[model samples]
Target chain A: QTASPAVAKPSRLGLCASCHGETGMAVMPGAPNLAGQRLDYLRQALKDYRDGRRDAPVMRAAIGPIGAAELDALARWYSAQAPAAASAP
Target chain B: QTASPAVAKPSRLGLCASCHGETGMAVMPGAPNLAGQRLDYLRQALKDYRDGRRDAPVMRAAIGPIGAAELDALARWYSAQAPAAASAP
Candidate 1:
């Protein structure tokens, strides 16, 4: 129904901003750049991390107790950005 | 030095093919299609899963004791594929 400013500008979002950089460019090695990533992929990834299907402790810690709505917001926010491909690996 | 036949044909390569589909199209709802994904991202992902940085039991069991060379091979194989979009949640 309504929008939260935090959800609107995901680049500046807390925690996620650290390793993933402001716009999902990824600030460190081993972190996948989320910009321009398919919304479905980002959703699945975050979901997997939350559900223990994927092992990312930092991610779990960073995104604690996230629900479907929040996951969607975060995924949508990151997927729309222009991902930095070269910074990967 | 020389490529293993198993490594060459990644689409049919073991458990990865089960969920990711032959061409990385994704067989299930939570699976991320790997086609056209950046090499760096793929590398970090596989590495994270193997090293326990990412908590994927199925992945860990599927890829046991994988070395850098194998990781590179898998990453290269998956990255070279033409990823399928439109499967987002």
Candidate 2:
């Protein structure tokens, strides 16, 4: 197999960029880093936050107005970024 | 506020403890550590893996037969563990 091309940065990052950073390496404390996360997991999480299945007020507010396609784009963007190294041995 | 008491370990961890560790710190490569993750996120992820909403053959096989309450207990157990430090600056 070959390496995949870089994912495009979504135009509608909105509040997601504030906490999750432009590259999805969370800029805020307590915000989970999104870089290199599973695309499906990220997609589901955004939906959960938007629809209140996740029960996080801040995340819900951040994602409330976002639609499904935009959410999928965001998930792809984040999932393509390089994740920081693991902290544990 | 008082410190929360330790969460009890679920006996039905099954293959979870093999890759995710007894304490959720991920003993296997490519597996994300689960310690100190949000309880809701962990809960949702488990359901996702089991239901095929998030596709990972290993995870699906590991969690396929697990029930809701057992999954919740597992989530609580992992969420209560101390996370390793962040790898990023």
Identify the candidate with maximal lDDT: 2
**In model 1, how large is the Cα lDDT of residue A85?**
26
Chain A of candidate 2 compared with the true chain A, TM-score = 0.83
lDDT: worst 10-residue window of model 2 chain B:
B80-89
Q: Tell me how each candidate scores on DockQ against the true complex.
A: 0.24, 0.08
Candidate 1 regions off by >4 Å? A1-30, A33-41, A44-70, A79-89, B1-7
A60-79 per-residue lDDT for model 1 (tens digits) = 68877787887887888776
lDDT of 2 by residue, A1-89 (tens): 11125666688875687977776656665576665555656777777778766555677677777888898999887767664433111
TM-scores of all models? 0.58, 0.52
For candidate 1, what is the DockQ-based docking class?
A: acceptable
Clashing pairs in 2: none
Ten residues in sequence with the least summed lDDT for candidate 1 chain B? B1-10
Where is model 2 chain A poorest over a 10-residue stretch in terms of lDDT?
Answer: A80-89
